[model samples]
Target: MGRRSSNKQQGGGGSEVAPVRLHIDPERPAPRKLEPAITALRRGHVIVYPTDTGYAFGCAISSPRGIAMLRRLKNMGERDPKPLTMLVGSLADIGRYGHMGNAAFRIVRRLLPGPYTMVVRATSEVPRGMKNKRQEVGVRVPDHPVCALLGELLGEPLLTASVTHFEDEQFELQEPEEILRRHARELSVVVDVGPLWPDPSTVLRFLDDEMEVLREGKGPVPD
Candidate 1:
């Protein structure tokens, strides 16, 4: 068990926004205890939680409103928005949402649950707006207990984006207090697993017949 704190905006003309921060013990890694965060996400609220790369903000992939909240938090306007990544629970879930060829599947199955993001063609089940103009989406299965458990609790993939305040910065915010101080107003929940070492996941793209390395970060790319 851990402590919880929240912040809410008052006397506002807009929708009521209150972001709660909850702590999770890394050693325990309890999935059943994350019900509140799951409930918030089910209601189309975005959350900031720890991942293998660092802290990231995510929401239910099916919620357009949640996507909008995520976009607003990241300052991604509809006119030209950065493509959001999906955090899936397993490789099977990835297949359900993305069309993966045998070659792509082989590589993905071997390297997932690590620090990597794979870009693949999206399936019809994927929301239209969530994909790139090429009909592809970036997916990740982070190697962290909290996120893995959170994904299981939600029973679906989460639309994810790395947490970064400055564009030049390559890593996400690592401290829970700092994450709350900057983004708690816009977020719905922050699942803190203490402080994290800052880094970014390696991004790999599997297009038609080629495997291209998009960005080299914490994970090593296979030749």
Candidate 2:
């Protein structure tokens, strides 16, 4: 069996679709729940859950099967994969995932723990499934307890970010318990820390030569 398992209800032009739900405050240790969440990803499960900024949905970086599952969830048809932005606990922890220079470091230090996603070069350790194919990756530092708790427990940088299964809008599912009830079979576990903001993280991509604002949202990273 592939790493991902899904049980979705399709409502489209004769296409199979998976249901996306929210899990809010379940009866489990935040990290214990995270184990299954990561397990599902390792086994190829695409999930949508809460984040510091809003809700982050994606597969586990360590799982190529999960990456393919996420791609299918995103409906991506490209041959090579493009790196997606991910949330990290802090700047120090991201050393294995992407490259953060002094300038990028200064900028990220100023805007993270608030709401912002920084696009930068990827390190060799970046997953081939998640890297831009050219060694570039987008990274973020979230200032929320659940975000830290999950990272602390997992002991690895999770590729958590705000992405939608459907196009034309950002993927924002804010309820944890509801999500779990709907797709429990699809996921091994769902972490229900608590309610979080209903907003998405702000996006900023740092060019080799300069800084460029990609998408503006809740958290305002300064110049």
Candidate 3:
């Protein structure tokens, strides 16, 4: 019973489908554990992992395989466009991924380092999951360390995918270990480095100096 081996409940799905899972983790970043989590993503598995804002279900943002797996598990409609959010390791990547300005900076300045999602233009490397109905994408740089570390280790932005396990769940997990085991085989890895926020990031669309509230929870948007 190594920490890396979480319990993966066999979710019910079509015989040909792989069940999506949720994972919890220990309080340390064991390379042994992280490697499995990363492997899960590399293999196209959908996962429920913790982030700065809360516990989000996500996949490797650049992997179509991971995105498709999430789309199937989410039972999203064709017209849904499969939009997802990118969790960048730092503020620098936001420019590489989207066009930003003083306005975008101000908006991000207040809400970020916490729970907030900013919609921006899609770069060539962005995953299809983040694209809008017409190909736009959302990006976030969380104030949490574990998430940032994971992004750095992966050498890419993280995809903030959604899950419905808990009703109105915030940006943190209470029983991460159990969660990890519940979705063991289905997850990339579970990293519970330390304490984390228990809410989701404030979500906003910032483009051309305008702002729109996609979701009104966690961090609030100013008028």
Query: Which candidate wins on TM-score?
Result: 1
TM-score of each: 0.88, 0.71, 0.74
Tens-digit per-residue lDDT, 35-62, candidate 1: 7789888888778888888778888998
Ten-residue stretch with the least lDDT total in model 3: 13-22
- For 1-223, candidate 2 gives per-residue lDDT tens digits of 1122265543111225433232434333355445555554555556565566665665556766556655554555435454566667777756656666677767777676777777777777777667665567778777766666555665566676453332246545456655555444444444445554467667777765367787787776566
Flag regions of model 2 displaced more than 4 Å: 1-30, 33-35, 38-44, 79-82, 163-186, 193-197
Number of backbone collisions per candidate, in order? 0, 17, 23
Write down the lDDT that model 1 would get. 0.77
lDDT of 3 by residue, 1-223 (tens): 1242333343221123333322334334445445555656666555666765556666777777666666665665546753567788767788788766787677677666677777776777675555767666778887755566567667777676654432454334445555554554445544444434456556787666777787776776676
Off by over 4 Å in 3: 4-33, 165-188, 192-198
The model with the greatest lDDT is 1
